[model samples]
Target: MDITRRRLLVLLPAAAVAWEFVRAGTPESAPNYKTSEHWWGMLIDITECIGCGSCVRACAQENDVPDGYYRTWIERYHVTDYAIERPQVESPNGGKEGFPMNEDSSGKNFFVPKLCNHCADSPCTQVCPVGATFVSPDGVVLVDKNYCLGCRYCVQACPYGCRFINPKTNTADKCSLCYHRITKGLTTACAEVCPTGARQLADLKNPKDPIHEYLRTHSVQILKPHMATGAKVFYNGMDGSVR
Candidate 1:
């Protein structure tokens, strides 16, 4: 073994033990108390959406999402007889005012909310070499930045392409379903600020929640349901072609 490198390696075990003891005393070690059975999800009503971008702004403001990065976004689609096209996708700064016009002769238009779906069998978690990316007991997918090696594997494995590597933190980041806020008994910023209630969050496991009610009453679809990751996000009145 190289002498210099070998000496450094020998000290690493002692350093790791000291680091763990220090971290254990910090506030971050606070117990993660919870009572939920599974991860909750939202049902977005596309028909009710006016292409308003309120959720986008709320998410940025609430999470301090970096410039050119989005934890949540809206996509506008114009469907026509000849073809379907996306007119506007992301306007990070503007809220409801950022909605784009269809400008198509077909006059068919709608908006869809896009975010991390927190799949039960998430490809992101599977590809993470370190245990940084993991599914919570309640089914929420999360990234422990402290453990993340910043390999960007989770970013590439995401089918929704929702994950992004944060330049500031040098770690993979994505929607946490507002894990910090939700755990505090507050609604997600996107759901809380959504005008017209187009986007709503609730527990799918709880049949009493409005999301479950909507699922029972309407034909809902998940993005790429055929992938069978058991995505919890539901889309109401979504065009089959969009999937």
Candidate 2:
């Protein structure tokens, strides 16, 4: 059967150790979603991004994302002679950048970081019949590989088309925002690798965090605003017409 590839292609390793733990444990012990206090999110500053694709490389290295698949990617929108026609966008190195700069022509380029929106009312979790995917108490949406039946309903329902079934494990996967790394008192690999400070990881509960400050200062919008999934990912300076 020809499979519809709906997600980025990166060659990250399977979560062999983590999956073992998940399968061995009972689901009742899965952390309650309401009691957690912090909500993790990222603020993407389009103005600051240089289309360098450093974040993409960092995420792949840190998470072992598969060669063709990406946990995060950069979108470089290039406008050309065609006005009504859409801009050309490419994901070089799974969107880590390093493309030779094309001469400035009729095309104008802008860089936008892309990732799973991690919606509060995510359509992915809604389609999971076995309760494999769930929203964490801290508001980080994640998938329980143990409970996942390799059903691709979440992949089909996601508007951003960010979810993919792992080739090694045959389960749906996407950016967890480095949930394992974050819970261990470390920043996400992408955020850590961002050279221009374009990506900012913040605790939504922190009144003093810069994410709130950025939102207060900049014009921000989430991807597919009309979807109404209450997506947590926020993009500043995103062009409405561009995805």
Candidate 3:
């Protein structure tokens, strides 16, 4: 109430200095996020998947995907005797819950988790007339919702049926390999929640990543190699019947 000009000036500078200190003490939003430094990919170990659908549930909760649509899902493949080529695939509700018991025990049953391959030469990106869909420098395929025309060109171009039109945004949507989380140094939702360690987030650009060793020792393959999309999601112990 009795402050002079001199007191006001001195207090103002001190308050400014205190504010700067507080800002410095706060955790940085990002210390050093370099998108170009990491090339992202995923590794799904088919043998390890138990059809529990934990990954599917986690992804749905993390992404807030609409009902009946999935950024990631699990398919239960039933290969009957001598019917390896035409395995019966079923994913009710995108496998959000663990599947019912298979009554037909005559055949071998396995679960395959599916998601955006995030191809290096992505057809979805190529067919987008507005360039809304793009592969990041780190190899994650992402869609700019604001820039998308909602024409569904990218949806049609995708061979794996990964891309879908978001009901809310009316724009192309798919897995960014959890780019928001990964860029902040966290694993994808699916990978993090997997109880069997079946799902793994990989950085191909990092030679030290366990994916390299897994590839070296296991017979890994990409879905639809003939599509030549340079798919980064690698499957270990994948059956031939998977499409």
Top lDDT: which candidate number? 3
Candidate 2: C-alpha RMSD after superposition: 16.5
Instruction: Tell me the spans in candidate 2 whose CA falls farther than 4 Å from its real position.
Output: 1-35, 81-85
Which run of 10 residues does model 2 get worst, by summed lDDT?
Answer: 5-14
Global lDDT scores for all candidate models: 0.78, 0.78, 0.90
Question: Which pairs, if any, clash in model 1?
Answer: 39-138
Model 1 C-alpha lDDT per residue in residues 1-243, reported as the tens digit of each score: 565977889889989999987765644454344646546777788888875778887888887788778888877665665555434343434333576444554646667788889898988999999899999887789999899999999998899888999889999998989988776667889999887888887776666677766778999889998888888888889985564
lDDT of 3 at 79: 95
Q: TM-scores for all candidates?
A: 0.80, 0.80, 0.88
lDDT of 3 by residue, 116-154 (tens): 999999988998887888998889999999999999998
Worst 10 residues of 1 by lDDT: 86-95
User: 115-226, model 2: which lDDT tens digit per residue?
Assistant: 9888888998888989999888887889888778898999998898888888777888889988877666568888887888888887888687778877888888898888
Model 3 misses residue 170 by how many Å? Answer: 1.0
Residue pairs clashing, model 3: none
What's model 2's overall lDDT?
0.78
Candidate 3: deviation at residue 54, Å?
1.4
